[model samples]
Target: MDIREYRESDWNQVWTIIEKVFRAGETYAFSPEISELEARNVWIEMPKKTYVAIADDDEILGTYYIKPNQPDLGSHVCNCGYIVSESARGKGVASRLCKHSQQVAVELGFRAMQYNLVVSTNEGAIRLWIKLGFEVVGILPNAYKSKSAGYVDALVMYKELKT
Candidate 1:
């Protein structure tokens, strides 16, 4: 598999991956009913950069986007969101996308990375992020409206990329 910058041609595949995850409403904060146009804006246009993980056969296995965590003074801290095709889960697609995102973050001059709304029930992602050097900086009680778990807690994770 290989990782590379996202291209317009990747949108359909990328959206398919994200749409299912978003519709699940278990991990990300996006609305389950989020429209394609809205998703396109959020996943592609708004982020500083977006990337995809492609398989040997050129299938898009996963995708991620990196952008400023906040505006102005807080811009040095970047934020990212990732999604792996359900079929690719447990194959390290998400992990690879995250690792690649960090390298891209530093190359983009970001000093740190933050994930503002990681649902606590997403153990796999939490474990991977911790393994990759991020820490739980804070927790928001009943912040995520999970489809299966009702209102669940959300975690704020952070990592310093450059001293």
Candidate 2:
């Protein structure tokens, strides 16, 4: 697996991954009915940097975006979101993207990284993140009206990067 900055030409495969993941109503907070343009804006427009994980043949396996947790006074801390292709789950793609994102964030001068809205019911992701050294700093009660879990809380995780 390899990780790299996103390019315009990557959107075709990127969108396919996004569509598959978000439509499943499992991990991300995005609405299942989210349109392609809206999805583009959310995944591309909002982040300071976006990255894709690809296989040896260049098949996109997962993606993530990093941006300031808050602009102006809070730019030192960054926020990130990730999505893995359905077929690529459980294969460490998301973990690789996450580890890479932290490295890139440090190289970009970010002091810390945070995940703002991780669904509490997503045990696999929560476990992976914790194993990756992110701490659950807070929980937003009933933040995600999950399709299966229903009104689940969102875990706010934070990790301080080495300067």
lDDT of 2 by residue, 53-116 (tens): 9999999999999999998889999998888988899999988999999999999899999889
For every candidate in turn, the CA RMSD to the true structure comes to 0.8, 1.0
Q: Where is model 2 more than 4 Å wrong at Cα?
A: none
Candidate 2 whole-model C-alpha lDDT, 0 to 1: 0.92
Residue-wise C-alpha lDDT for candidate 1, range 30-98, written one tens digit per residue: 899999999999999999999999999999999999999999999999999999999999998888899
TM-score for predicted model 2 compared with the true structure: 0.96
The most accurate candidate by TM-score is: 1
* Local error of candidate 2 at residue 121 (angstroms): 0.8
Which parts of model 1 are misplaced by more than 4 Å? none
lDDT of 1: 0.94
* Top-lDDT structure, candidate number: 1
